[model samples]
Target chain A: MMSRKVRKYFSFTAFVLPAFLFYFSLSLLPTMQGLFYSFTNWHFMNPKYGFVGLQNFINIFTKDRYFVMALKNTFKLVAALVILQPLIALLLALMIEACAKWLQKIFRTVIFVPYMISTIVGTFMWSFVFRQVFTQIGSSIPLLGFLNQSWLSNVDLAFWSIIIVSLWHGTPLLMVIFLAGLAGVPVQLKEAAVIDGAKPSQVFWHIKLPLIFYSLTICMFLTIKDAFKSYEIVYALTGGGPGWATQVMTLNIFEEAFSGNYMFGYASAKAVVFLLIVLVFTVAQLLLMKRREVEL
Target chain B: MTRRITPLYVLNILLLTLLALIFLFPILIGFLNSFKSFQEIFLSTLSLPKSWSLDNYITVFQRIKLLRSTGNTAIVSALAIAGIVLFGAMAGYKLSRTRTKYSTVIFLLFISSMLVPFHAIMIPLYQMASKLQLKGHLPGLSVLYIGLGVSLSIFMFHGFTKSISREMEEAASIDGSSEFGTFFRIILPLLRPAMGTIIVQMFIWTWNDYLLPVLMLLDMRQFTIVLSVNTLFGEYGNQWNLILPALIMAVIPVIIIYIFFQRYIMQGVLEGAIKG
Candidate 1:
């Protein structure tokens, strides 16, 4: 009886081991390996590597201007996305909720179409829209002639262009998420508020906002994480070009390792820093939001 | 449910229509210019295609090997999703059912890795893949995805398995069913809702992934749809005649999937956002 109980407990391993094998070799082991590699000078071409300790991290902080620039650009994008993406998505969700049922479906479907398409595909299409279609529209409508500026080539404008494209590609899914949250707001609560002579906007602020606060936290978390990990839209749209004006951390780390730099060890260090920044921001956001959630 | 359509409601509809049009403008433009000749595209992208010709589509189809790449993508996505759902469900179910120190540690191991960005691990993963000779192969890439994907799938299933009652499994066991037999017969069927969410999410992520494929696939023939289209874009810079058509073709599959699985996809996204 004792042996049978022991054998029964061991049987659970059969269910868990297959998935664990793949995950350990590919995900968990590589993570530790990456941290280990960060402390060494592991060049892509060179087989031999030596421990470099804190040199790579120090250099990234003090020496590499490009890394610094990428850091700044990443923060800029994240800030914009965290603030603006949810705001737009929330407004869209609120408006869609106001529409008739059938119209709501059409609006939701149309807005989300861009999201279903890959970021690269959508970014490439927008590149055409910015270059050719903008010029055509600018020339045809004299009042809108300013739209003909070199959107991708210009440094300042290129950043905005990436933001515009990212928002276009990203906002719809958040909108759908917000729509779900809004749907969960109990109808009776709103009706009760309205019976008390609360206007629609007032009811929204008092009743709906508190109810959907959880979704707000989720959107904020998703936006911050996504903005930090953003690669495809910027990579395809500008290839981190216009003189690396739009480079983010992922693109920087990728180019360092692959695009002729071959600084695998140094890139690994950048990857570590990238991971830390994301972890800090997202974990902090979650903690903060969880506290706020309890308050409400 | 009937209510008066007030002025505020009219304003809402008008605003939603305008935003939706803005959302669809680039896609609509890409579709229109895909049918136009090169010079026509340059002349006025907003204008209708003069002839609605299929010449550019034919060229793009042949140039990018769209059919072949699409097949490759489909194969990769299918294999990866199958592995993820099976392995994820089994492990998630077992982990949720068990209560031991090792189980807690194992579950934490899977959950904690969800926060690590892929770029942080890409270099080491690539090196590991090369060492194992898993690089540059479709099945190997699917295996990598299974590894990368199983964490989230496990998390989802684990959360979902809690809501499933243990009575069925207990009953099956008392009826002389073996453990594996009970799991397959009792727990697996009860896991369908979680499976639907997992399958939809996994399919979209694997199908639309670009960076992983770009890193893993070496040969043009093995290239997925996005890779083929990207290759065309690189080789023919500013040649909208070729690029636009491929762009249009690349998005058609996802759009179709969205149309069919809109409810499931939206629910999956909502669940992922909230729980993940």
Candidate 2:
């Protein structure tokens, strides 16, 4: 007969083994291998490769202007999204909350519809608007004539075009999150503050904002991370084009490995750097935000 | 509170109504234009279509292999969700129940790697998939999803299991039920809410995902709706008549599912955000 401890161990093994095997093979192992490969001169065609310690990293920093441009563009997108998405979402959520009950549900559902669509589809849909619909409107209305700019082609305009598409695709979720956060803010607290002769804005500032600081942090973190890793929209809307105008970090890494030079090791190094940036920003934000979360 | 319609309230409603219209505008245009001939769309996009025609959708449906790609998507989603829900539940429940140091370490190992972005692991994963003969295959892609997805699933399950009582499992064990038997017969049914959340989340993710499938599946027959639609767009860049209908078709299934499960989807998003 088996000892009781042996049986317990066996059960644990049986339960955990399936998940661990897949996770290790697909996720953990690849991550470790990616790190290792970043230090080598690996190529798909060549069977053999040699360690070229730090060359990939050095090349990305010193030699590759497109990589540098992509990095800057990613940060720019993150900055724009981190500020704009939450602000718009929070405002819309507050408005929706204040609406009639039936209207609130209808508005929330309608607003979130775009988010349910695939990113590629949504981006394509917006591209049509930017290309055709806006031009039609621009020609018909004298007052809105400026609406006809080449949204996806001209470099400066393309950045904003990508941002607009990303915002449209991304904001609905944050709005829903903010709406959920708003629901958690007790009505009694707002009523109590109002009974004390506080203005609506004052009550919102003093009571509601603190109560939903946790949600704000979450929304901001999501926006930042998502914007930094922006791909499908940029890929569909502009193809990171009119010459790399909207290329973000993920697109850069993808092109490096797959599309352009097929430099797998070099792309892995960029991916590692990308991962570190994401980790640092996300961890720092979480730590800073967690401390500010109100107990109530 | 008095039911007074102040200027502030009027402005708020108007502003919100305008914003809501803007939010709906793109999809509205896409839907409207999908029924228009290319000439009609080019002539006047803002107006209602001159005549609502089924020609665009008919052509797109015939050309894009919508039914086949949708089936492929369904297959991938089903296999991935099944593996994720089953294995994630097993690991999560055991990790939560067992108090051993090893359990703690194993649980942490899964949890900590949740922060690694997919791009960081994409290159090596592609290499691994190729080496393992998983490249260019749908079932192989599903297995990769299980690996990439299990961490978050396990985390969710682990947290959920903590909220439920353990007495039932213990009693079943006392009555000479094997551990697997206890899990399957007793505990799995009890995890309905969590299973629902994970299944919906995984389905939406795997269905909408563009990058992974693009990397893994090289064959046209293996394309998901997103991949097929992307290919259609590339082939017919300026052909909005064809592309818009395909776009609408690509999103139709998800939108239908969303409408039916609106409440659950909203709750899942909020819960996932807060928990993660």
Tell me, by DockQ, which candidate is best: 1
Tens-digit lDDT track for model 1 on A1-296?
55976876778888999999989999999999989999999999899999999999999999999999999999999999999999999999999988878988999989988878888888999999888898888889999998888889999889999999989988998998889988888888888888899998899888888888888999999899899999999999888879989999999999999999999999999999999999999999999987766233
Give RMSD to native, each candidate. 1.3, 1.2
Candidate 2 residue A97 C-alpha distance from true site, Å: 0.9
> Cα miss at B134, model 1 (Å)?
1.1
DockQ of structure 1: 0.86
The per-model lDDT (C-alpha) reads 0.91, 0.90
- Kindly list the per-residue Cα lDDT of model 2 for residues A1-296, writing each as its tens digit: 99999988898999999999999999999999999999999887778899999999999899999999999999988888888999989989999988777778988999898888889888989999999998889889989999878888899889999889988989999999999899898978888898899998998899989999989999988987788778899899988899988888899999889995788888899999999999999889889998989988
Off by over 4 Å in 2: B1-4
Q: What digit string (tens of lDDT, one per residue) describes model 1 on residues B1-276?
A: 566889978988888888999899998989999999888988889888999889999999998899999999999999999999999999999999898898999999998999988998999999989988888989989999999999999999999999998898888888999898988888899999899888888887888899999999999999999999999989998999999999999999998889999988888877877888
In the order shown, the candidates' DockQ scores are 0.86, 0.83
Provide the lowest-lDDT 10-residue window in model 1 chain A.
Answer: A287-296
TM-score of 1: 0.98
- Cα deviation at B243, candidate 1, in Å, is 0.5
Predicted candidate 1: what Cα RMSD to the true structure? Answer: 1.3
Winning candidate number (lDDT): 1
